[model samples]
Target: MIKTQQLVKNFVSYKKKPGIMGSIESLWKREAVTKNAVERFDLEIPSGQIVGLLGPNGAGKTTLMKMFTGIIVPSSGEVEVLGHKPFDRDKDFRRKIALVMGQKSQLWWDIPAMDSLHLIKAYYEISDADFKERVELMAELLNVEELLHIHVRRLSLGERMKLELMASLLHKPEILFLDEPTIGLDLIAQDAIRDFIKSYHAKYKPTVILTSHYMQDVQALCSRLVLIMGGKKSFDGPIGEFERLLGSDKIVSFNFSSEPSRDFFNAFQPKWSDNGLQVEIAISKEELCPFCAKVLEQFEVSDFQTEKLPIERIMKELMMRPELLNDR
Candidate 1:
């Protein structure tokens, strides 16, 4: 279980003046701009629940995770994980949760992942029998059993990530804090990691807080989500609630049974141009079926399908919108 109240992180940024003379002068008079990575935030994640923490860059997703994991203390407010204050950095708290950042590597570059696992076992004071069992189980689940003997630096990104997961889960923590778990990997690797995560969640039911650039990760693993737009909470609820925010900018597309004159698509803007009268439209909330029927009355409609905008595209659009900077 995890909870936060008005969780906030602020940093004082230094601004440098251009030109040699100005740069020298700036040493004594450095500009201090304050940035709120997370502000007045409140969240509660129940045990055995996987919550996707979604946001664009600088939206405080990582900051929130750091606060939750005791890597960084919140500038204000309180956070608790498994009923213990996270910033206290207690040994029990440390053993109860795991944090994995995509860009950060925890594996020893020149050593075999198995050796690293052994080191971690000693560090955690795990029994030899327990460590061996966990290592083998995690390796099999992640499909990296054969790769364990290979040096980590020689392993592929996917392999390294697999090893990372195996290493992190050695103690079988109750909470998982995954940040961009599938980032910088190919589609095949992404799917493999996603599948492993899904299967793991089903089997172990660990509390998960995942922040990923890949929307598919969220779609596959998280039924609930908390969207961080700018430094504030944009939407907090089930994944459907966050998906609803993209409803206004939905898309409707279909094929035409018969090609009609330009007048068929003249009144409305067509998002697609083709040899036939088939078209797609990126429109706001409107009766898409009736609107499509108006075109269908004159022309035949085939392969009709209505789809909302992709989650990635919608999030990018929302991130650029200034109005979303301080969301409710």
Candidate 2:
């Protein structure tokens, strides 16, 4: 479990004036500017839940993660993870939490991945039997048994990522922090990582906090979502509620063998494909059945299917107009 109240992290930087004369003047009289990377943020996460933290660049998601993990101390406010203050860096607290950041590498490049995992095992003081069993189980689950003995620098990003996950989870931490776990991975690799995480969570039931730019990652793994914007909490609720922020209209796309008349499709506010043979329409929930029936009857509909409101589109809209949350 994790909890934070009025959690704030401010970064201070010196404002450097342009030109040599300004630089000379700034040595004695530099202005200190403070910016709130995360301000007055509050959150509570129960054990055994997968929560997705979402925000755009410079939106303070990482700042919060760092604070939660005690990688950086907060400027003010209180944060507790598993009944211990993270900033205290207590041994038990560190043992109970694991953080995996995709943009950063924790393994030594010069050593084989298994070697690095062994170092981790020693640092965590894991028993030999437990360490060997965890390595075998996770490598088999991630399908990376062969790559474990290879030098880390020689491994591909996907392979390295799998090994990094194995190293992080060997301790069986009570809470897991995944910062873009599938980032920079190809489609197949991304799916593999997601599936592995799902399987691991089902068995161990660790509390997971995931942050990713990919909405599909969030959709696949998280039932709850917390949206951060401008260093503030804008939305925190069920994933389904986030999807419906743009309204309950159903998105349905139709692929036609031939183009349909503009007049027939114009009433539906259809967005046409570049080739004009495909179109997507947004239909109200009440009219969805009748509209699909009518379109099927009237058009040469080779294929058609309905989908939920896309989370990507919703995120785009929310980024442009964060005030929409007030209206909701």
Candidate 3:
């Protein structure tokens, strides 16, 4: 469980002049400007939910995660995680949460991953038997049992990320904060991580907050999405409802034995592929059934498929039109 009421974080930076004289003048007359990294952000996350935090650069997603994990204190407002104020950094609260950043590593570069894991075991005060069991389970789930003994620096990026996740989850924290856990990983590696997250959540039911630029990661793991812009909450709802904001448009594709006559699809404005055997068209939700009937009657279709608009396009539309937030 987590809650935030008008959570805000402001960063202050001073402006400096170029020349030495101007710099000396700046020493006494320095200009300090405050930038709001998070502004009046309110959020509520229930236990056993995988929520995706999405936004563009400078959107304050990372800042919010830091506040949740007790890594940074909020400038104003309130934040509570598992019934404890995160800013207090209580020992028990720290034990209930973990933060993993893809760009950063907790494993010792020159030592084996198991070595770092052993340190974690002692830090968390986990029993030796429990620690061994947790490590075995994590290794089995991630399929990285062999890499545990290899030094972190020698492991590939994907291998390092897997070990990072194992290290984070070994203590079975009640809340997990993941910021770009799959960044820079290939398709196979990404899928493996996604599957592991899904399985772990289903089994343990820990509340998970994930921020990722890759749409696939969000699609695969998150049921609800919180979209933020300019350090403010833009939209918060299920992924399906977010897509519906764009419209009721659906893409329909048809494959035929051969190319149809130009006049056959002129009225529909279908986009044909280079091979000329396939055509694609966009139709509204209301017209889908009727259009399919017409196409079935007019052409000898070998195969047909329909798909909703991609999340990427829907996100782009939301970014362009911030007013949609009021519609929520």
The prediction achieving the highest lDDT against the true structure is 2
Pull out the clashing pairs in model 1: 257-300
Give lDDT tens digits, candidate 1, residues 13-100. Answer: 9898889988998979998999989999999889999999988888899999999999898999989899999989999889888888
Off by over 4 Å in 1: 248-250, 255-270, 274-278, 282-310, 322-328
Of the pair 1 and 2, which is ahead by lDDT? Answer: 2
Q: Which ten residues in a row have the lowest lDDT in candidate 2?
A: 305-314
Task: Give lDDT: candidate 1, residue 132.
Answer: 80
TM-score of each: 0.87, 0.95, 0.88
What is the per-residue lDDT of model 2 for residues 1-328, given as tens digits with 9 covering 90 to 100? 7999999999999998899999999989989999999989999999999999999988999899998898899999999999989989988899999999999898889999999999999989999999989999999999999999899999999999998899999999999999999999999999999999999999999999999999989999998999999899998999999888779787889998888886776777899999998999887889889878987888898999887438888898888888887888
lDDT of each: 0.83, 0.91, 0.89
Estimate the overall C-alpha local distance difference test score of candidate 1: 0.83
Give the per-residue lDDT of model 3 (tens digit) for 9-106.
99999988889988899978999989999999999999998999999878999999999988899999999999999989989998999888999997
TM-score result, candidate 1? 0.87
Please list the Cα RMSD from the true structure of every candidate, rounded to 1 decimal place: 3.2, 1.7, 3.1
Point out where model 2 deviates above 4 Å. 19-22
* Sliding window of 10 residues with minimal summed lDDT for model 3: 260-269
